[model samples]
Target: MIVDAWFTVQQIDEATYAISEYGHWEKVHSFLLLGTKKAALIDTGLGIDSIKRITNQLTDLPITVLTTHVHSDHIGSHGEFDSLCVHEAEEDWLISGIKGLSIDIIRKNIGRDITLPTPASFNPETFTPFQGKPTGLLKDGGEIELGERTLTIIHTPGHSPGHICLFDKSTGYLFTGDLLYDETPVYAFYPTTNPADLVASWERISSLKGIYKIYGSHNTLGLEPSLLNEVKIAVRYLRENDLAKFGTGIHRFSGFSVQF
Candidate 1:
């Protein structure tokens, strides 16, 4: 394994790697999935450092950055990649900046709660989230073929209008993005989020068959597929009690929790 001052690289398989920033409070994780002809990078980490440095060491194939969402933390290093693809719902936000989200809040969130030394280039005061056009737009059910491997895009919105989850059909690996994760509450209480849609998304992913493992963008590196069962129960509970709305506080399930 390659050692770095930042970014912990873990091998999930010979063709897949999890690039994580455990030092950051969010514990953001970016994935590198290698195919025979190309590679797919799922969301860059916080712009505390250049994630391209790690990707370069992982593969020589052309990298296609598949953004799970346009959140500041997820797209921090988006500018470092040339071929970027985001959901059609977030295409405008990608070209422009996420509306109503203040740079001050972003800077504050990115700068604080750090346990590791950040790169000198990272200046939260002046730190700007990557904003530009995407090479293409992806939609729900859209399939991306990286040589022999195929990633199916799931439009699991609610956390954000354009938030998505990627499913690796061949490996049965589901990259849930921010839509699902353990530890901290999955956020849907923000003005931009829709709690109802979030529950629906949880139901959608929970119903997905043959998921071997779940890879969320933050906190834990991987979750067992059995957690999907818990998600199903949580979704039913949230919808049954009519609690899938903002200001509902935190709803804890057996394996995960959500705030709406």
Candidate 2:
């Protein structure tokens, strides 16, 4: 394990790591998957600290960032990396900041509920999300080959238009991003979110062939693959009851929950 003031690095395997920030309310987690040729960084943590500093110490392989979405918290340190890839649907947002979202609101959220001392380099008042052209755009069923290991991208939109889940073929690790996670309600209530799409995404992931472990971007680090069974049930119930719509409030299931 690697220790740091802002990020907690946990080794999932000899070549995989989970870099988490527990000091923040969101409890955001980023994953580093190393392959024989290169490494893929799932997402960057909150911009309060530079994640590159930690990545530098982890591996010598050239890093390519795999963006699950274009949300602020997830792409906070996107500028720190050179080769960045995002879903084709969110390519515009990566080039230009997400529209309709006010900087004031974003700043407020980033500055609140912080339990650790942030570096002086971060100024919440001036905080702004990264906006730049992506080096590559990914699509559904896309395969990212990192030498010996290969990751398949599943387009699981809902919480965001381009939200995606990465499935590592070698490890059976499914990185669900914000589409699934525990401890906090998966958000789909915002104007940009789609309740119907979220449920559909849940159903899509539930049907995946072999998922030995489930890893989300927030809250709890890793969830049991059995939770996908609960997700299937939740999706069926939500659709049958016509509850997949805006303002339906929070729907709680056995191991996870969603808001819309």
Candidate 3:
């Protein structure tokens, strides 16, 4: 196991690892999946410290960074990677930055709520999220092949216009990004979010077959596949009660919660 001052690395399996930043209040998690030919890094953690330092110690293969959405916390360490892939819907946001989201708010969020010491190199006052052209754009049914391993992109837009979830058929692991997580509410109440689309996305993913485990981007690291059943029920209830819209508050379910 590799140890660091800011990031905590945990092995998911022989070829997969989870790089987490527990010092931040969000407790963001970034995943690294290694294959015979290359590797895939799913959403870098908060840029409080360099994620590349941790990744460099994990694998020697080339890494393709897959952005879940254009959120600041997720794309914090994006500048450190060469090959980046984002959903087509967020291609503009990735290149030019998200519209209307001020840097002041971003700085406040990044600077506050710290449980551990950040690196001396980090200065939230001057912090900026990475903005550059991605090497490729991902689509709903796009497939990324890493030697014998394959990852299917599920365009689960709602949390963000281009928010996506990755499904690994070989291992039945669903990387839900911000679409699902435990402990904290999966929110879609932002101006860029669509409550209806979010609910539909939840319904879409809940019906997926052979999901062995659920790995969300924040909060708890892994969830059982049974939580999908609750998502199914929550979807029906939210739609039936006409609550899939803004200002509905947080809807708590058995294992997870959502804010519309």
Candidate 4:
């Protein structure tokens, strides 16, 4: 374990680590997976502080940031990395910023709710999400090889048109992004969200085989693979009752909930 004033670094395994910001309301998590030849960083955390300060001490290997989506909270520290990869569907959003999301709202969300001392550099009033060109674009079924550890990209839209989940085949670890997580409801009611695609994505990930553990972008650090079964039941229930749409409110399940 590596202790810091801001980021909480937990080693998931010999080659993987979860870089988390627990002081913020969102409790964002960014993963670091090291391989023989290179490394992969999954979604940088809220840019309240420069995440690069922490990552620099973690590994010496070159890192390629794999964005889960283009949301402000998830891609906050994207500007710190040299190589960035985002889904093809959101190339414009990554380069030019999301069209409808207001910076005031973003400032409000990132500025509020804090339990730890923030860096002096973090001024919520002037805080801005990173925006630039992606080094590459990700697509469904794409494989990112980090030496012996290969990651499979699952295009699980609904949370956002470009929301994706990463699967580490060797470890059976599924990083579900915002598409699935416990506690606060997974949101899909925004103008940019698609509820139908969200439920379909739930159904798709629920059927994945050999998922030993599941990791979401928020809340609890990791989840049991059995949670996927509950997702299957939730998916069926949502479809059976036609509740997967905007203004449907919140649908609670055994371990998680989704808002449409």
Candidate 5:
């Protein structure tokens, strides 16, 4: 069975927020401090009507939305925000605003008559299509200073060539995009995910200690200290182990060829 449109928000800390995707759950998004003069949206949901409706209902605090990557689902909706930032490697997709990859996959999975309000899907007059101008170019070591808060830009490419994560050094909070997600990492059938790099990226992410609250692009951060360890174990396991040994669910996303 398929799922319908829906949105969810979770409070990460005093001011941080997490936004989720509409259907067939994966990749949890994080929004930081809507009330703090300048709030930062870590990742945008699929640019579907469900996400758009909920985004409008949320606090309108001169938001500065920045995507962790340019996967169809994470960035398609971001076109609505006037100004946002993204990793340099994915800046082209953000500017190009191409569709076809994840959009069709999600729609098919949902089995619903849904249409995203993007330039390709809808006209500007009908609804505001997200055509954001990128103001910041995120580098591997660059840091984003929003008001008093800061999110370090760590380039952990794997899921995509320029995938990034936001680390709040002050709070020791890590907001990983698709590069480090809770779901059994999906490999690229259409040339999006790079399996070899994804497994290695986990090693890089695990190096950071005292990471109190960790998050993915799909679900609320469960303070899963187990996640950190699990990631490390998963990495080494994939390096030597045959992915085919796992159940079909693990390989169903992209075949058993690539390990994550």
Candidate 6:
């Protein structure tokens, strides 16, 4: 029987691809970090109902979902996973709901105002229904075993202090959340966004060796190996706006290098 998978494995390695509910916001591509027996889903998309449509296509294998940060688009379906993992720093944000300003940014990015209904368990007075919950807290170097494989949680703060990247050192695959993207990274964000820390994250990531390929939480799966280098393009854009702010040269992520 043919089961249409929500994620397609990258032809080159232990990587899987899926699109976020927000298709036009280009940086919204999510990924599956697969080991031999189990897989880790990185970043859920903007809309929970849409997440069900995408996840319904996934394998019956037990899956654990994690978010790079608590932004609404990245953690919309947090409750779907048996256990949801997020950086400790974002725990409050997840429980309280994402920043009000980011939603407006998303609306502008998507070119429309999409108001999602709250989940039944939520109280409209203090809580939002559509916003999901985080079940576990993760930190840098934290490891999770999915069957025979182990994925390392690299805390690459900046985009958000708790922002994380999943690295499969064995396969050289890094699931970079918004901290590194193929588009203009938005440094001017609400709640918490430190361009300096983000630049440091680039330096930290550049040290990884044997990184066969890189994936983004947003729209960047089709990035041919060659195009993956465009993270520098993002850094350059950020630099033009304020080079001195980052404390050093821009750090970019192409498939081969994270330029700083």
Task: Name model 5 segments beyond 4 Å from true.
Answer: 1-6, 22-30, 34-36, 50-60, 97-133, 188-190, 220-223, 241-260
**lDDT tens digits by residue: candidate 3, 146-219:** 99899999999989999999999989999999999999899889899999999999999999999999999998
Candidate 4 vs candidate 6: the lDDT winner is 4
For candidate 1, the TM-score is: 0.99
Displacement of the residue 107 alpha carbon in candidate 1, Å = 0.4
List, residue by residue over 1-260, the lDDT tens digit for candidate 4. 57799999999999899999999999888899998889999999998888888888889999999999999888989999999999999999999998978999999999999999999999999998888999999999999999999999999999999999999999999999899989999999999999999999999999999999899999999999999889999988999999999999998999999989
- Over the full model, what C-alpha lDDT does candidate 1 score relative to the true structure? 0.94
lDDT scores in order: 0.94, 0.94, 0.94, 0.93, 0.62, 0.61
Quote the lDDT for 79 in model 2: 94
TM-score on alpha carbons, each prediction? 0.99, 0.99, 0.99, 0.99, 0.74, 0.72
lDDT of candidate 2? 0.94
Q: State how far residue 229 of model 1 sits from its true place (Å).
A: 0.4
TM-score of 2: 0.99
Higher-lDDT candidate of 1 and 6: 1
In candidate 4 the C-alpha lDDT for residue 183 amounts to 91
Task: Write the residue-wise lDDT of candidate 5 on 115-194 in tens digits.
Answer: 32223543323333244558878898897777677778888877788888788877777877765555454443345556
lDDT (0-100) at residue 190 of candidate 4? 90
